[model samples]
Target chain A: MRLWRWIVCLMPGLLSAGEWSGYAELQGRYFPQDAAYENQSDHLISLAFQPEYYQRWDKGNQSLLVVPFFRWDSEDKERTHADIRELIWTYAGNRWEAQAGIGKVFWGVTEALHLVDTINQTDLVENPDGEQKLGQPLIKLSLERDWGILDFYTLIGFRERTFPGEEGRLRSHPPVDQDHAEYESDREERHLDFALRWSHYIGDWDIGLAHFNGTSRDPLFIPRISNRGEIKLMPYYEQMRQTSLDLQATKGDWLWKLEAIHRSIDSGSYNAATGGFEYTLVGIADTDMDLGLLGEYLYDDRGDEATTPFQNDIFVGFRLTANDVDGSELLAGVIKDMDESSWMFNLEASRRIGSDWKTSAQIRLWSDIAEQDPLYSMRRDDYAELTLTRFF
Target chain B: MKLSLILATLLLTPAVTLAMTAEERGLEIAKEVDSRDTGFHDFKASMTMLLKNRHGEESLRDMRNQTLEVEGDGDKTLVVFDEPRDVKGTALLSFSHKVGDDDQWLYLPALKRVKRIASRNKSGPFMGSEFAYEDISSQEVEKYTYKFIEESEHDGIASYLVERYPVDPNSGYTRQQMWVDKARYIPIKIDYYDRKNVLLKTLVFRGYQQYLDQYWRADEMFMENHQTGKSTLLTWKQYDFRSGLTDADFNKNSLKRAR
Candidate 1:
């Protein structure tokens, strides 16, 4: 706490002049069904604070941004964490650009799954949706041409993915023992990585192609007996190579998206793809609300051997936008297994309460889990959550 | 004898314009308007939007706008939000075209992501205000067909009333009536008619200002909805032109870095 205060106090002087902005959120979760594992809680509460500082100079050609995040969970020790989300300095030239420091980058265009998004590790303890990510240290360079934009990155350090603790509401059958993690590379977390991407747009289509060679962001877990003779999941990281393609086309009220990836490990290789479309009916029933229907198909060649549950699945969703002063929106989706009877359903709604405050609610339900399914452990973890945020 | 006839014909063209069809006269007037606004190059401004409901409760939104003129095409524009703290640092980028749908992308600061949005919602409200997407986009001469209704007076100034029909079938309004100032060839007022051919809204332009001694821009735009009893007022300031903005400043990368 003293260190945070010192940095906040000295930032204004060290940076000359900068602006501060961010938010504080309070979240509460309640589980309706019984816990799927022992030592789990049925209710949980958390508070998170993220503050950002930004400054620009040299006619907006150069700038620096800093974002630090901290959270406290009432039930899980692993969920109580703090980290820097972004601390990057950028320089924009006429045709070339450079950036250095820890930052976050997202690269994919799909609704059901993110097959091509592998720049940063997921911060899963924060949310089950896998949308939150940890910051990565890197140096990047970009060139802008008439044809497209090309980017090169040299990733410096690696960050491990976070999982729910034993006392957390959502967890695998056997809790993960992060302290006893193993890595295939001798250098372990110090493994260096590299990536390159080219993106362009033509008429109504936007396209991106990328390649990454380094430590895989997704880890394979192996069950092991710990020192106390208790069974725990141990994560193993392996080095791999991946090439991906993402495409999106916007035509009238319809948006078509696709993401495909081919990854090769030391032993074998696999392929995965997700493709979908979202069509909106504007001004439905003489009102200003928009109703959008989304459908996506997910496929993985590994089938039963895949670590993910989306080997052969389909997702259908609805998105409603009120377009009112409060910026109201709702999204509900269902993901069903094609081979099994397992399914997952989720609903999320949010709206601004006033000028600075916003409220959101989410519900997740799982049903009819098969023993071979990856999500069988979570069949009893149905939960509902509410969050209120105040922004500065 | 040939030279004398050519001279006579040239002299009669200006006065005998009444002999031309209404469509021809309207197209000529539109051409004049477009010609007068040719060389702006680029511009930047700050705008404040005031939205009021039927109950007279008001809300405010503040944003900054930048525009770059494209030769033989429509303009490129970027709008970044500043006020209403929750939406700060959010931005929208658009590439308008003359004959097809405009391409648009929205930047969400919280997620640090840029999403390509469908631009077919031309009649939807912008920022919960009475202004629709089409009302704020770049006006190209090819987007509409016009007919001259009459030459009359508006607010003590000489004006020409022209009726224009949208070329795109997806447009919400069937037609719009515009009053062009005689001296400046700028729009002074516009009445939007719904698909049912009924007057739905009226927009009045006030506080006209000229920049670079050639471009005329309105400082205030007031729009009122007749059936809903709602209104929106837009006030603009700090109009800077020729700011040297290039294509590099309006791309996906730029949208992510917008502050």
Candidate 2:
């Protein structure tokens, strides 16, 4: 409480010196069905605040940005957490830029899945979409030339992915025991990582090629019997190397995107790809609204044996943009398993309330999940969430 | 004396016919407008857009724009949003071309991703304003076929009226009528006709200022839709030219760094 008071007092003075902006959000989630796990709440409320401070010096070539995020969840203790999303310093030169400290970088072009965006760890407790990320400590250098833009990264400290608690609504029957985590590398969590990427655009085609060697961000779970006569799933992180390619071509009203990755581990190697296209019809029905039709196919060579559930799946989505003063938008998508009859449906809608406020609604549902499917554990955890955010 | 006068008249007629045609004259005027504003290497400006609905309700949007001039091609532009707090750090990068479609990319700050978007929707409203994407994009002489209509006076200023037809099939307008300031070679007013050859909108530019003693820019632009009764008022401020901006400042990396 004292620390919070001190921060509140210092915020005004800091704003007078630099540029400051952020958002505070109130979120409510409703689960109309019963929880899949024991002790899980049917309804929950959460609050989050993210504040960002930025300052530029040396003729806008050098700058510092700091963002801190905090969230409080009513029922899920693991969901209540704090993180420094970004605290980075950047310097730009004639044809090169260097950045250091904690940051986030995204590298994929597909919509359904992000196969090549491996820079940051996923904050899974935040959302099921996997769009939220935890900042990663890194030192990055980028060089721009006639050929292309090349970036080199040295990732230092590593952060493990967050999972829901036992009492969390969206959890497996047997919760993961993060305390008993194992690592394939001798350095464990301290293992350093390196990555490089080259990206460029020619005509309407944009291409990116990247490589990463590091401790895998995705962990495999191993069921173990505890000494207390309890069964728990222990996470095991392996060392892996990945090569990925992302490509996009924009032609008239059509945008084509493709992302593919080949990851190699001590055990073996596997390949996965997600490719899709979005075709838009502008000024539909004699109005200002635009409709976009999207279709993407997700494939994993390992098929049902893959760790992720996206093996042999097809995703189809529709996006509507009102192009109105309120910036109204909506997206509905469904992912269907080709091997099984499992399906996951998602709907997201958002609109600006006023100049400084916004409201968004999201609904996620899983239906007819097969017992052997990885998503079968929480098939009954279908829920809808609404969030209202105020920015300052 | 009558024979000599006839000979002289015949010779003068040929000279007048060879001087220039209407299409050539219009093209020359368009070139003049483009050339007069050529030497401004780069510029930065803050802009505000006021959108008025048919019911008289208004919404405001603020953004900052930076443009870099390319010698042979169209200009490179970067627009960063500021007022819409939800999209505060979002930025758009465009590389306008003299022919074909322009290349555009949008950067989302929350996801830290740059997405290449289709630029074929030139007729769609820009930021839900009455202005379309083509209405505000960089104008190049090659995009339209021109014909000089008449020399007239608009708002007490001597101007040249020109009718230009769009060359692109995707353009929403069949043709546009423009009134170019005779002295400054800058467009003072424009009337847009829809694909069906109906009057769609009228745009008026005001508050012209000279920069570098060679370039003229409008501080305010008003666009009104004739059928919808909705309007958009665009006001620009802090126009700084020759700010030492380079090509590197208009790339994908630059889009992410725009704040």
Candidate 3:
């Protein structure tokens, strides 16, 4: 393929003029509960590699970037995959800039729910947290002016969200069928998506307004009978429109943040919002450590039967930063459903090992999740994970 | 009675007229330092940071900084991390003021979000460096109250020793002692004491270079934390002044586009 030739020809140039950098990580997760499936294992190991290449010219006014990521999980077949994280060429003028290629975009302010972030497809197989993403191809333009900055996006080919395999520990039972995917759009994945945002800062407040219209990245799974006479959840992508507002106010040690959105899908239209504040206590106990207290309220209009979670929920958490040489920090939080006793608790900690190495660990727990809850399937998937990474 | 009254008046008047209050001398020196650093307009420079741990392990980070001087107030600055693949695309925008709360924003590349960091007390370290957030900011004359300590000599350079107290209640340090060079009106060394009045760190500036025939910049700055046995060294290069940078170049949207 011509792509292979391009890769071969670009190798030498990338080593000399362009910068090549990446990281490799080995991770392991252990579960306290017994294996839930025949092929499931209590212990799992995964190795991941991410390599990036970047080249810039004209005093950094123009550039090209390429980043490829791969992960190989020993226990779960679906977890082993490869993706192009970013391969964008960018240009910047005096007052405007443009980029065309595959990349990722994120928008949100809340810590618990990220109600506004919807650019890239979620790589659920990589982690249940959904912070990782598969890059999307798009053309982006941004204009900077006196009052604010305006950004425009033209999204092209869409990437479908990935799911954990049957053997994966954090997955729904019986698995969701990926091959029988259907889309409301006649063109399926070829459907175009568009988005725009205007952001500004006034005094101590930073605000952003954004809108998106496209094939919904979040699919609706319908229980269907397959050709093999087995029941499976069929993935259905629908057309949807969403508008969001994100706001944050920083005064002294307090950060007040809010993110709200209104989404309209063929199923119906709904409004959801999450707002919170974080108060930080710096130099606590006469040391350089900082402790941040966070509280947020989540609301949704659809109520109990709503497909979206976080209907009448509250999140409380704390983030502790050591301010050490390694940049060590720990964050712990719990989101409690007000309608029920269901709660999801998570803990994350990371620190540097040496000059080029870093280590991190995470723990997640779900308790009293009702059958109607969106996270009901993951109720028993409590896990503790550890990863050591090396960068070049 | 008349003789005694005249004697007392003469003694008191001489003492009052001869003795300069520490506050007066302190303000005079601070004014001099500010005067020498004025009218820079803007600047761009590259820096290499060396971080060392208690065990003597070392790490390096490369970065570029651009600062636009705002008249009548503080300066607007931007720092872009260039090395260390993890933080390459990371940029920090700061709008510093002499009084009141300064504004700061951090752009996280991996998350693709510009987070407005809480800037109540800037006592936190700047990216795990020995320099705290407050230390990296441009020093304005109004940020601290100063008192002349004494004159001292370091490395054979005549210097004026002064002690400054932070005006904000949120400062992590109780006081700081600075040694300013007599010839250049520049701080050559400083000692920071913690809230407990304990010696915390000492910073030294070396390799002073003058640019634009009027501006003075240091080629290297070293900060040593006495309590933690850690240190950070910043080596600056390519000092370019009057780069035609404007206020629009330091906005939040340009944070993501920073190279």
Candidate 4:
């Protein structure tokens, strides 16, 4: 922690031409369904702010970045929190580059599920799309060549996943006991993780292979009896070894993507895959607009016993871009289970208002959720959200 | 292919004996333009884009652009956005080809992933501005077939009018007419026609400056959408040519590090 303080103290003078940029957002959510948790409200408001500073020295290709984010919820106590999203130093050489400190890295190509993207801990409280992640502390080096890009990582200070508070809509029936979460690795939260990836592009195809060792980002749960006679889910993180592959083939207006992973945890070894394609129709109806159609298949080897939500399911979505000066766009999708005919529908629309302002509307719904589903408790949390963001 | 045909025609009908059609003369003018601006190698510049609605509402964006000249093929370009906090640190890498489809990719900093954009989207607006991907692309002579329209005076300046049709089937414009300055041989103004043969937009180039005593560039470009009552103004800054850039600097991996 001393090193973090030292970097932050000196971050303001990293370069002469550095810049500061970020955004502040205000959101209002409305739930039409009955309250899924006690004392939960149908209407809620949230405020978030993120501040960032970046500096890049032209000499030796050195750079520094610092980003701190915080969220404040009106009702949920646990939902309000603060985090340092990024604080990294980077240096680029003629052939190799190195980066150290807290940052984020992503890997995967599929849309429905991210099978191989597990570098950073999931920031589950951020949104329903599962796209936001917390900063991870690590040291990384990469070598660039004609063959491919080879990268090595030394990960440290593992972060635990965050969940919605008990008073939030997306919470599980029995609150997840994060404070008492246990770890299978003897090193606990200080576990030292290691990872590597080799990526290359050949003609129209981009492929990557990766491997990771140490603690798994996802946790396994056990039902424990509390002192109040209430059942709570005890979160447990196990030592894990994961190997994965991601690929994308771009040809004309069609893009085919695939992500597959095989991992071994405390219970056993499992395999999962997500494959999909995106086809776009440009200038639809003689208007300067684009419509993208997406289809994907997600499968888990655990079948009915799988803890993951996506198992033998189909995901279909469409992305419409108005291509106007305001950058208006709409994305809607549905995930349907093959066996039970259960489903979840989502819609997200956003557009720029002026130079520095943006507005968005979001919707989430569930229907006919079966008991066999891993997240069946969230069926009653159907809600919609509206947000306005100001950029600087 | 057009070059070979021009050569064959030149051999059959002697240039000294005349009999050069407008097509041949138009090809000659294009060749001249290419000849004069051939060896820039690579260049980088800062750009400011201003978007204005018909009501005079304005918005601005800051960006950095770099381009590398390929020997026998089309140019490679990279654009990194620095302003507008929502899109800050977003970079676009484009490899323009002489024939068929060009390759393009977008790097989203927040997502930390590089996505290959559909080439068919080249005709769509770029970043919600009046300039489409095709409009901003490095205009190589091979991408268009040209016909000499007439010699005329445009904007009180002597210019040669020419009509060109995009070779790419996915281009949004059915045809375009350009007025090239007689003195500089650089395009000074352009008129675009939509797919339905309706006038869609007009682009004007101003503040022409020469660099390295060999290359001509415009410091300001304004594009107006006639049907939508929208317009965009792009001001070029810090135009530095031949900065020792290579193909290695324009690859997909470099996009993530562009910031």
Q: Which prediction has the highest lDDT against the true structure?
A: 2
Which residues of candidate 4, in runs, are more than 4 Å off? Answer: A1-17, A58-60, A227-229, B1-17
* lDDT tens digits, residue span A71-123, model 2: 99999999999999999988888888999989999998999999999989999
lDDT string for model 3 (B113-184, tens) is 889988876788877788898887989989899999888898899999989999988877899999999999
Docking quality band of candidate 3, CAPRI definitions: medium
Query: Cα deviation of B101 in candidate 4 (Å)?
Result: 1.7
Q: Give one digit per residue, the lDDT tens place, for model 3 in A122-238.
A: 998998888999999999999988778898999997888899877888877567886778999999999999999998889899999999999898898888887887677888999
Stretches of candidate 3 off by over 4 Å are A1-16, B1-21, B53-55, B82-85, B150-152
Residue B107 local lDDT, model 1: 93
Q: How well is candidate 4 docked (DockQ)?
A: 0.62
Worst 10 residues of 2 chain A by lDDT: A9-18
Computed on C-alphas against the true complex, the DockQ of each candidate is: 0.75, 0.79, 0.51, 0.62
Q: Second chain only: TM-score per model?
A: 0.96, 0.93, 0.91, 0.92
lDDT of 4 at B242: 97
Could you tally the backbone clashes for each prediction? 0, 0, 1, 0
Q: Write the per-residue lDDT of candidate 4 for residues B134-204, one digit (tens) a residue.
A: 99998888988888889999999999888888888888889999998898898899999988889999999
Residue-wise lDDT of candidate 2 within B96-164, one digit each (tens)?
A: 999999999999999999999999999999888999999999998999999999999999999999999
DockQ of 3: 0.51
Please give, as one word, the docking class of candidate 1.
medium
Sorted on lDDT, best first, the list reads: 2, 1, 3, 4
